[model samples]
Target: MSDDQSPEPQIFETLQPADLASRVADQVLRAIGDGRLRPGEKVADARLARELGTSRAPVREGLRLLESQGLIVSHPRRGFFVHAYDADELKEVYDLRECLELHAAEAAVARMTKADCARLEAQVQKLYDLADEGQTQEQVVQDFAFHRMLCELGGNSRILRLFDQIAAELRAGIALVGQLYDDPEEIARSHDPLIKALRARDPARLRAELHEHLQDAQIHVVQLFRTGAFDLTNLDKLSDDQRNRLLR
Candidate 1:
């Protein structure tokens, strides 16, 4: 190698105004998680623009981003609406989730460091803390983060990407449908089994624990959809405080 060889010049394209779109998209997700937005509700981008203090273009783009992720849907002339989930749609998502995470858990146990296991333990403990406080929304976010780590630790780029693609819908679903149990600790403590399996470095146990956990969630979420629990909730009310709290 020639030390004096000229290096290729870095070419950078002008960045698009995607940050605003992403910010708007994040606020929309927060609102959905907060129960300010729900299934089958119209998403008025104009109102969101005023709430976000921007033009409608970015708001529309943001909703489009979510639509790509299956959280929002567009109608012919009626603007956008929150995607109304049913049992069948949920079944597909959960089935895919099981297929991915079970294998990911097996791979994770094979490659995870002690520090990695410790990090997982800390996250699980945080779930207990959040559950104790009865912060359902925060618990939903934390729960998603905990399971998302499985794919991250698994060290498979494709699996991680796929998980991310479905993540927006997954997070929204968890937030909207909520837990089946009145006892938050039940769901929080359920993760303990996964940690135990991981600590032992037993792939079979890890997969079994993860499978059962996901299966339980699948059953719970599908039942919620079947019973139309979320159909009547959060029809239309984007409060200033909710938007500000979410966006800011």
Candidate 2:
């Protein structure tokens, strides 16, 4: 084709704000995981809209969703920025997790069905196979599923809501630690004891194992930060629309 007769690029339209926001949220969260969006960076609405090839409305909604998940923060007049977990925030998150998980364990013991436990066992088997196959990310996902199953078995809506909230925060940290460590065996070792305890239906041991697992994750997160594998400051670049979502 001649220079003056360039081929027309594909033009797709009909983007829905709610759906677009969800898509934006997923993309931004993954970007955060991969260190593209550093923690504490301002998220500009206009810039993000421009980058995503969409309008600011959906970006605002998406930012709101992420902010609610504790992934970002909004400031008056300034804009939205990535939210970082300080020492106290970190401790509180894990401590709450420990309490919720302990309660979940007790509930699981009292209410878990043969089928629920069987499904969990199947998850454990999948993790073992993934570990053996050396699929690190798949193993991490399965590991999360295993604990999520225990939480679901508890049969409590309040606990389920809290678990979902904490799980989102935990996933970011888990992904960071896994990338830094690059050791699936270590992850398996940590998970195996928890699985065994759950299998035995021993609430006491289950609680202890779950607590240990969170502690191990916390330590790994710190280690990753110290080694410069993860940085919180990268979020300073988020646009206002992104931050507003957090504050709202």
Best by lDDT: 1
User: Candidate 2: global Cα-lDDT?
Assistant: 0.68
TM-score of each: 0.69, 0.68
Model 1, residue 25: distance off in Å is 5.2
For model 1, residues 1-248, the per-residue Cα lDDT tens digits are 58999864422122245588888887787666545676789988767776667788888988999998888999998999998777788789889988998888899999999999999999999989988898665666677778889888999989988887666455435554345778887767889999999999999988888888988888877777678775443322324443233222
- Residue 190 lDDT in model 1? 86
TM-score of decoy 2: 0.68
lDDT of 1: 0.75
Candidate 2 local lDDT, 1-248, one digit each (tens): 99899774422223445579988777777555545566677788777777777898888888899998888898889988888766556656767877887788778977877787778778877876877898765666666667767877888888977776665455445455446445666766666776687678888888887787778777766566555666444223334433322221
Colliding pairs, model 1: none
Give one clash count per candidate, in the order shown: 0, 22
